[model samples]
Target: MCIYNNADPNSGIQSGGVYWAYGPHNLSNQFGNHFVMNNQYDGAWVELCTGYNGTGKGESIISAGYGFVEDLSPINSIALGTGNNYPCSPP
Candidate 1:
């Protein structure tokens, strides 16, 4: 996943990667709407969480090959995986 500091998605400071998984990957001090690029392959997906370490409520699901400009203010973490059992929100 590539997170952009700008909402335009076309250009901005880009960060993040495909290596992070089952993480609380806390976005400290990050605010406003940003562009998130989900580059995961093989049907893998990403989940945005409200709490740290894959806890709390699940916010949104970013499927592979999809990208969106989302508000990062309420999102505290992210989880990457495939299948029904999500690492951020179980069951």
Candidate 2:
């Protein structure tokens, strides 16, 4: 799974770019920004980002690369908003 936080000054991440992210257990809700990406076995990715990162639904998920299960918290699996420059260029 990938997450691109355009305005994330802490991670120094840029927009229009894809990144693989893991559990954000300690992610802060200041301004309510953060993301949790899940790489399913179907070669597809599931991304969840929300205002508190669903602290209540915090659970563990098994990573693809490593069989180890990492702590994961499910958030607003809904797409609250979309980027303006969507319909991205063909990869």
Candidate 3:
């Protein structure tokens, strides 16, 4: 279990100081991804995306109140409070 801070748009692939938890060194592992809801913002959503900076179509959005415990081996990046960007809401 790892905790990633808020991601910075400037950092691109290396955003959020989360590299240590989700960096290239650890991303290749076949471990399943898990995310817990720690955000206080109402209606906030966490997203697991295939691209950096939380931009792309193949994104899995986790709602503000839910947690993710799935095989996210294919995802490379994550973000919080990015629900407005994606057309589909978190499932």
TM-score of each: 0.82, 0.21, 0.50
Residue by residue across 1-91, what tens digits does model 3's lDDT show?
Answer: 2333213223222233232222122233333434433333466655665655554444566665564444556665565553376532243
lDDT of 2 by residue, 1-91 (tens): 3333422335533253233443332233222343433334434323233324323332323233322222223343212112222121111
lDDT of 1 by residue, 51-70 (tens): 88767888888999899988
Candidate 3 off by > 4 Å:
1-30, 33-39, 87-91
Please identify which of the two predictions, 1 or 3, would achieve the higher lDDT against the true structure: 1
For candidate 1, report its TM-score.
0.82
Q: Which of 1 and 2 is ahead in lDDT?
A: 1
- Cα lDDT of candidate 1 equals 0.74
Which pairs in model 2 have colliding backbones? none
lDDT of 3 at 69: 48
RMSD of 3: 9.3
Q: What is the lDDT of residue 51 in candidate 3?
A: 56
How good is model 3 by TM-score?
Answer: 0.50
Clashes of each: 0, 0, 0
